[model samples]
Target chain A: MTVSIKLARTVKDLLQMAQTEYFDAGHRTCQGCESAMVLRWVAKAAGPNTIVIGATGCMYVANTTYYTTAWALPWIHTQLSGTGSAVVGTAAALKALMEKGKLPNEKINVIGICGDLGCADAGGLSEVSNALTHTKYNFLILMYDNESSANTDIQETTMTPYGALTTFSQVVSR
Target chain B: MEVVGTGTDAVAYALMLADIDVTSAYPIRPYGGVMQTVARLIADGYLKAEYIVAAHEHDQFEIVKHASAVGARTFVGSSGVGWLLAIEAIVAISTDRYPVVALIGNRALDDPPGAYGVEHNDALMVRDVGWLLVWVDTAQEALDTTLIAYRVAEDPRVMLPVGISMDGAFLTHSEHVFKIPPKSKVQKFLPPYDLGNRKLHPSNVISVAPQVNEDWVTEIRKQMDEAMKNARKVIEEAYRDFAKIFGRDYGNPFVEPYMVEDADVVMVGMGTVSKPIKEAVRRLRAKGERVGFLRIRWFRPFPTDDIIRYLSGVKVVAVVDRDYSFGSPFDGGAVFTEIRSALYEAEHRPLMMNFIGGLGGREITYNDAINMFNMALDAARKGRVEQRVIWYGVRE
Candidate 1:
C-alpha cells in the first residue's frame, strides 16, 4: 500500500529494488536536468501500479512527446495549473468507482508532478491549496520548483525574481 | 414527479439522477446556484457524491475532468469570466475525451466591470473546440437535456464532453415547472457511465492524451471529429429511447420548428430568444402572415440537415444572434455565419440575413421579433436581403 514511501537504505536493498523500468529511456531533456532525475527516482519508487499526472513543464514537454513515451506506467498530462486538482480527482475517482464495484479495489499510488511555473506562477497555487484540503483522498502532489518557467524558453516566473536582475546586469554591463 | 425550480435546479436534479460520483464547485453568479442546491441535496441525504469546492474555476473543472477519466460520472459548471478562467481545463477535458457534463450559465464575458445577464458569446467561444455544445431554452429542457447530455457524451461513439448552455437570467435564474424522472426509470433510460478499457485504473494499464508533435496531432483531432460526426445518430437514439421510457421526446433532436410547415419566412435563433420569437410567430400567423420560428438546440453539431430541411422551402431566413462576431465575414454573428455556411450547399437556398440583438441580456421582446419578421418578409418579396446584418435593438 505504501510502495512509494518504501525506503531503500542498504546497497543490497537498492540493487534488489524492482528491476522494472517504469521511467524508461528516450526522453528529450537537457543534460543534467535534475527534474528528470527526480521523476525517474519517484517513478521507480512508486512502482508499476501508479498513475502519474505530469503537469505541463520540462518533464512533460521532454518526455511523452507526440506518439512517444518513456514511461511504462500509466500517465496522463495535466494543464499547467491543474497538477493538484488532477491528482485529487484521480484519487477520488479511484476510491469512488472502486467502492461502487465498478473498478477493482486495489491499492494504487496517485502521483502528481508539477514544476515551479506550472504550480506557482501559473495560478496553480490555489489548486494545490484546494487539493491539500481534501484530507480523506489518497494521493501525493510534488511541486518541483525549478526557479523559472523553464518549459517556455526559461522565462521569468514566481520562483525567478532575480530574472529582472538579468536586465539590470545587462544595463550595468552596457 | 413534477416540481417547480430554477433552470440551475433542474440541472442539479440531473446530476443526482446521473448518480454523478464527483463534482467540483466555485461560487460565480448564476452557475453558483446549482452547486448550492447540489450541496444541499447531498447534505439533506438526497444524493451521494463527492462535492469538492475548489478555490477557482481552473481547479473546479480540472477536478471533474480527471474524475471522469477514472470511471466516475462527473459534473461541473461556470459562467462568464469564470468559464473563461477555466479555459485551459475546458480544452483539456475535450481532448482528453471524458464525457463530463457541464452546465454553462451563459453570461456576457465582458471586461472587469461586466454585467451578469444572458449572452451566447461565452458559450460560442468553444465553437472550434471538441465539445458537444447545446442550448436549452426552458428549465424543463434544461433538466431533460442535462440528462441527455450525459447519455450522449458518455456513449462510446461520442466520447466527448458536452457544454449545456442555459441563458443566464432567463433560464438559469427563472423558475419553471419540470418533471424529474424517478431513479428506476432513469436507470432504464440511461446506461451506467463506463470508459471500459480506457478507464484510468491500475487494472487498465493504458496512458492517454500524452504530449504529441505535429506527427500525431492531426489524427488525434480527427478522432474527435469522427466522434462528433457519430454523435448525430447517437443523439437521435438517445432521444428515441428517452421518448420510449420518459415519454417526453424533443422530436428532430436538433431544431424545434414551430409553425414552419406552411410558412414563407422562418426566424431562427437559439436559447430563450425562441420564446419571444415563437410568440411573434403566433401574432404574425393571426394577422394572416406566413411566418415561423426555429429554435436551434444543438449548436456544435450545427444541425445542418435540420436547418436545410426546415428552412429550404421558406423564401427568407432571419437569424437573431444574441452574440456577435466583429470583423467576421459580412460582420454577421457566429450563428449567422454557421447557418450561411451550412446553406451554401443546399439546392434550394433562402435569402439569409443576420440580426444581432439581445446582447448583455437585453430582453428580446416579442415586438422586436415582429419587426425582424416584417423585415425578413420584405426581403423574401424583394428576392434580396436589403441589409445583410442589422443590430436589431441598437439605438440607431
Candidate 2:
C-alpha cells in the first residue's frame, strides 16, 4: 500500500502567486488598509469571472475616478446602502446567464464589503433581512472596523470606546 | 506592513489572505476607514476580488449573504448605531447559515446621551441572533480573529456567521506591530469556498427560508443551537491551526483568568475593558490583595461550564457590563443576567453582583475596575446581598 499526500498551495498562496495588475490606483487613503488589499487580491484570485458591486464609500470615490478605473473584472457602482439588492440582482443575472447557456461552469464569487457604520448602523438590516429571505445567491460580507469616520477626521461611531473623544462627542457633549 | 494601521485594514488584509472572493462596502462613521482601506487594496493590486459599493449597509449585507449562500466567503462591519441598524441583518445572516464575518466597532446605544466611544451594548444587543461573537482588544487580535472567524463560521458543523467586535478608538484606530504571515501559511490554513455542485446547480432550486411548521422551526433552531455548541471546539481547533502557521494563539472560548487561582474575589469583563482590568488586577495582587480577573472571551453560547468551574471556589464575583438591560429587576446588567443564570442553584451560588460601566464610550479606568472589586469584597464580607446592580464611574 502507498500513502500519498497531495498538497496544492493553500488559497492564500494561490492568491499571492496570482499576478495583480493595477486596474485602480492613485487613491489617497490608508496605504496598507485591508479593504484596499483584499479587493485587489480578490480581483486576481477570483480571476476574470468575478463581478463587483461598488457602494458609496471611500472605495467608490477614490478608486473609481472618472472613466479611468481600478477594476479589471466586471464591476458596478450601486447606490449607497443598496449594494445588497444590487448584488442580488447581479446574482440573479448570473444565474439567468448560466441557465441560458451563455456563461461557463466556472464558479462566480460575489462579494460585499462595507464599513462598520454602514453595516451595523445604517442600511445593513434591510439588506441582510432580504438576503436571509432569499438564499439562491453566493456572496461574502467583509466588514472593516476602523473605529472612526476616517474620511471626516475621526468622528466617533457607535463602535467608539468610552472616554475616547471624537468629533461628534465634543459637539454632543458641549 | 509594519506601520501604524487600523483594525479595519487588518481585517481586509486577513480576508484577502484568506482568499475571499467577493467584497462590498457602505460607509458610515468610525467604520468608513475599513472601506477606504479595501479601496486602497483594489488600487494597489493587493486584493483582486469584486469590490461592490452598495447604496447602504443593508444592500452590502444582501450582496455578501447571497454570495455566501453559494459558498463565497464574505465580510462586513458596522459600529454603534450602525450596528443597531444592522441588527435585523445580523439575525437574518445567522438564520440563513451564511459564513459572513462582521467587524463591529463597540459603541454605546443611544438614549441617555452617551459619548462616541467604545461600549459592549452594540454587540450584546444582538447576541441572541445566533452569531458567534468574539471581542478583540488590539489590531493584531482583530486581524487574527477575522481569519479565525471564517474558519470557524465555515465549518460544516458551525455554518453560522461570526461577529468580531473591537473598540472603535482603542483597537480600530491604534497602530501596532504585526507580522503579515507568508501567503503560503495562510493558504494552508483556509481552503477555497466550495459548496457542493448539487446545491448550486441551476436546475436544483431550493427555498432558503421556507414557511414551515413548528417542528421544522424547532429542528432548524436545534441545528443552529448545536452548530453554536460545536463552534467552541471548531474555534479551538482553528486557533490551534492558526498558531501553528502564524505563531500566534487565540485562547479557548472561555473567560481569560488572571490570578484567580488564589483569590477571594474576581472581576469579569469583555472586549477592550479587559486590557486595563488585567493591569488593575495585577496592581491589586502586587499590593497583597487577593483579587483576580476573568475576561469573557466568547459572548454567545455563553461559556456556562467554564464560568461555573472558574468561579465555583471564588468567594465573590463582580460582573462588569458595558451595556444595560433596562427594566430588569436586576437593574439592567446584561453580563449579570447571563452569569446569574449560569450560576443559578437551589443551594449555594457565588455572591454575584453586577456593575454597569463604560456606557456610551465612557472610560472604565484602572481605578474604576479596582473600586468595583472593592465594593464586591465589601458586600462579600457582610454576607448580605448588595444592590444587584451598580454603576461605576458615574457622577451624581
- Local accuracy of candidate 2 as per-residue lDDT tens digits, B1-396: 564677777877787787666666776656667778877886897865556665555566666665565445667888777677656556767886777888887766566544567777788877876898887767777778888888888888888889888877776776777666767888888866554431333333322342345547787888899999998888778888988888776555456777888778888888778877888888888888888888887787688878887788677888888888888767758888888888874134788888888877777887887788778878878876568778876788
Docking class of 1: medium
TM-score of chain B of 2: 0.93
Specify the poorest-scoring 10-residue window by lDDT in model 1 chain B: B201-210
**Model 1 lDDT at residue B127:** 80
Model 1 clash pairs are: A66-B212, A66-B213
DockQ of each: 0.72, 0.06
* Collision count of model 1: 2
Model 2 segments more than 4 A misplaced: A1-174, B1-3, B111-115, B197-204, B213-215, B345-348
Put down candidate 1 lDDT per residue, B6-70, tens digits, no spaces. 99999999888888899989998778899999999999978888888888998999999889888
